[model samples]
Target chain A: MNTPFSPERAAELGDAERRGSAAQLAATSGLPDTSSEAWRYSPVSDLNLDELRVVTGAPPAPPDAPQYVTEAIDSLQAAATVSVIDGFVVAVELADGWVAKGLSVESAAVKLAEPEEGPNLFDHLHAAFAPDGLVIKVPAEVEITDPIVIRSHLSEGAAGFTALKVHASAGSRVTVFEYQSSESGGLVVPMTQFHVEQAAKVNHVVIQDLATDSWQVGRVTSRVEEHATLSSAMIAFGGKYARIRTDSDLAGRGATGELVGAYFCDGDQIIDYRTFQQHIAPDTLSDLLFKGTVDDESGSVYTGMIHIHPDGAGSNAFQTNRNIKLGDEAWAWSVPNLEIENNEVRCSHASTVSPVDPDQRFYLHSRGVPPAVADRLIVAGFFEEALRRVSIPAAAQIARTLIAEKLDVRLEQP
Target chain B: MSELIVDQLAVKVGGSQILSGVSLTVPGGEVHAVMGPNGAGKSTLSNAIMGRSGYEVTGGTITMDGQDMLALDTFERAQAGLFYVMQAPTEVPGVSMFDMLTASLSAQGTASTDLAATLSAEAAAIGFDVALLERSLNVDLSGGEKKRSETIQMSVLAPKVAIIDELDSGLDVDGLRTVAQRVEKLTNDGLGVLVITHFPRLLHELNADRVHVLAQGKIVTSGGPELAIELEQTGYGAYVEEETPEPKSGGLDDLFSM
Candidate 1:
């Protein structure tokens, strides 16, 4: 373990109690390189762990700075604006109608000694490393028109953790937009926990366009209540190594979850994604579609699964992963798994990993588009489906523009 | 002067020759029909002319208005006044027909593609519902609707040469009449029409100037409309292989060689 760290550096763990707790958390969280199912495709040990540092100071303020403005960010229906700097909640603006209670977002030193839920090791990690995060609570029967916007900024050499807890009461509806960016170069680890009450609805949007030299790790878990709906989107277009895992549980009858994602990776960028749609109640519906494109020597991995419990009869689920590699040097791997413990359920998964069709490109080129332009056109067309699902027009166009840049082409509007 | 000339052209797919030394010329203002049974390479001929990437050009030359068509890519060929209404047009999801058509036109460097203005006029001319153009390009469109959308595309692009591939498929009598009317209008506007089909019903309605019967990848017979009538009545028996085994004889050998 000391191979990469000197004796003095290893002593940074401080007291025996803190070292014991860190070791215990690392061990029991099943994050080991050997036995964790989730880590099978990705090896964290290969990340040069010792080289990663916790936040020492504020990240460099970007020129023309932060990816989103307060106005555009707050435009999401009924959503307020919350900005996090170096793992601390710097600014928070709640909506006018919603009254918040019993939820406090302060420095981790002011919170409990340990995470209330042991399974959420990142919560404890956030409590330890993060200066602050946020806690949002919605009481019963309240409906919000705007989506809350949360922007997390990371600068070079800045390693920070933030934990977001969103609890929606029965019949409450809310939408949250999470934007993550890295200024200069750095790494960020973010974990989010969502609790949806009976008949509630939650729509979440995650936008990641980090600096080229940054790395991002994000995990999201949701619990769906009876007759509730959770629609989530993860759009990743930049960063060197961006890994996202979204796990959802439909634990009550008539629950539905729709997950859509679109990513564009180029150069030596590596994008890893893992998702799970668990059915624990009858008549639940979960659909996931993620489309991506890889150019140059970029690599992408998508491993997804839909698990149905025995009591979860009459459930219907669908998962599709489609990607187009613009160059022979680019690579993509997709694996879709279906685990069924019930007899009367309907679930299907399909994945297509192929380069752009020569015929399709020729067809476009025959119309006078150059070969490179034709490739970009078809690739954009390939991603239009997943991108179209996004509600904001500017965000959609920005996503497509980023994709064009990733493919080394300009977005030529007709 | 925008003419298409195919001189002794040969095309192949997957190592099998489909069009062999086929020579035909389509002036800027005429309707030509290529009638044949299944496997006659009628569709293959149109696909080859469009420079569809999968096919190989084995021999001969294709020229459009004195420019070498074979030297151009599919899009370039399309830009040079050639439009192939695919037999099965790809259903591109999330791309609206208006956007796709206008983008295609702009890509080809067309100057008259104000989508909203053009769409309204074309929709009125074709009696197409204006709302339909806003939907995803060909996605969820019915067979007849897809054909109509292709026709709408033709109307918008207004290319010099328009190749219709089996426009009769999935169309009822009324739809066929509508398509024929549009094709007649296009032809009257001086656009060259190359209609590839097995059935001559649409050709007869549109009054083809020349009828070529394609057999085994080449035009075996070229004549007036009478040839289509003849084949429609005779059922391609002369070109098709005999179903029943004939005893070995010179008569059978002559019949075998078409």
Candidate 2:
């Protein structure tokens, strides 16, 4: 058995209350068994929880800037930049006029409390080991034109856990762009929470390009209140096994949420995504679209659910997931389900797994395009449908570059 | 000797014969029309010449400028300056017509600045709406619009040898006249053209140099442009046999001969 929870570790990390709660969770709920429905088709069984140790104190000096971070810094003229090294907040910089306008960023410890609903093993583990949390608050009536960027770089053989909380008051609007990269093999777990108040709007984008030997498990949960809008996009391109779970709760009437994602996995990589669209109030709307392509021996999994309660009458929800298989050994699994107890709601879900259309290829070939070039153009067009919906120009460009790199590798093969 | 030639060609699809020992030629600076009843292997001949898949050439020779085209892939033949305007253009989602035209022109070594100017000029000359360029290729387009877009593509490609298959089927009177005038102009400019049609109006307008009548997978007759007018007046029944009986043998002799 593992050593008992230490009071010293608690004092160095957070309060004793958080430590007790995390200890109780760790003792009661162990890692999920492979027989569980949610864990099926996932590589969680191969993970060893005991191998990861709690990290404390200051992290090593910040390493050289990663390629993705440099590219993002060059492309986005951000209003502020936050650098996180090994889950430690190293620096936070805001533009000149930002402090006077009621925008603040601070370091705080997150309370190790279980979610009211849908508590998982990873959430408990993250609560037990999180180093420090970052809190970003935007006051009422403050609108920021430039995006705030967050960059995370994980070093070799390190296990890091981090939490971030974003609060947008009524009538406020902000955009956040997060870029995560790694130098070598490691495990990174992160959790994010968003509270969008009444009539507020938020745009969030996450771009992950980790090393091939690394593993990432992340969670993004948001609550959109009355008349608020939330637009989120996720572009995932790297990692050995990268998985993210998103939960969007429309808590009040007239709220809207949109989720879009584009991912390309090659070689032996695996990208898994799970999304939950919860409509609890009347007259709310949620739409989701995810498109990805897998080549070589890679695989992808997408499972989404649209839940509409009885009070969620007059709500509209849509979910779509499409995947293209470029190699004979590549595989994709998509499962979209709807749970509706309401009588007067509109809900639809569609999922497709297919190879490239022969007619499209023939059409291109008849126009003098080579086979490899034709596939490249088709794949680019496939991702463009979702990328065009992204609001940030720099984020979209970065995603396009990653996708082109994957296509180039495939083209070079005999 | 620089011409598109098909000599005693035979083709099959899915283990069934389609074209049997058909011969035709279209020299430079001339127009030739192939008139036939439905299912006489007219489209098959065009498709075979373009090297489209599934049109297996059992015994044939297709050459342009004395280079064997049957040994090349579709894109290779296209790179060799062969073009074909299909009967039913395919609609590709998420790909714009302007992008396709640019890619085609760039494949032939056209510069970017020249591509835009040339495309605009060609579209205007063909009476095609410039707005169609922004829309997805052939998606949500009417039959007449699709034919017009094909004409624009042909003009942009400027191929050395062009095969126009059933260009008059979905066209209106004005569209037919426009296409005929375009083909006439191309032929006048020394581009070899093979025009396949069922109606005689396009041939009359084109002032075709030769007309070939195809029946039962073979050319039954060949003559000047008047042949099209004569066949239009009387149907193809005169050239096709009414009936032919199956041969029979005596049972004892057939068995003993073996």
Which parts of model 1 have CA positions greater than 4 angstroms off? A1-20, A23-36, A56-71, A100-127, A362-369, A391-397, A407-414, B241-258
- lDDT of each structure? 0.73, 0.80
User: Across residues B1-258, which tens digit of lDDT does each residue of candidate 1 receive?
Assistant: 468898998998999998888888888779888877777788789988988866799999999889998998777787778887766677655556665565566666664636788887777676667788887666787777777888887877778898889887766678778877887898888899888887766677778899888776777889888877876666565765566322331133323331
The 10 consecutive residues of candidate 2 chain A with the worst lDDT sum are: A1-10
- Which numbered prediction scores highest in lDDT against the true structure? 2
Indicate which candidate wins on DockQ.
1
For candidate 1, write residues A348-412 as lDDT tens digits. 89999898777665544544556666566677778888877775554666676667666654333
RMSD list, candidates in order: 5.4, 7.4
Weakest ten-residue segment in model 2 chain B by summed lDDT: B245-254
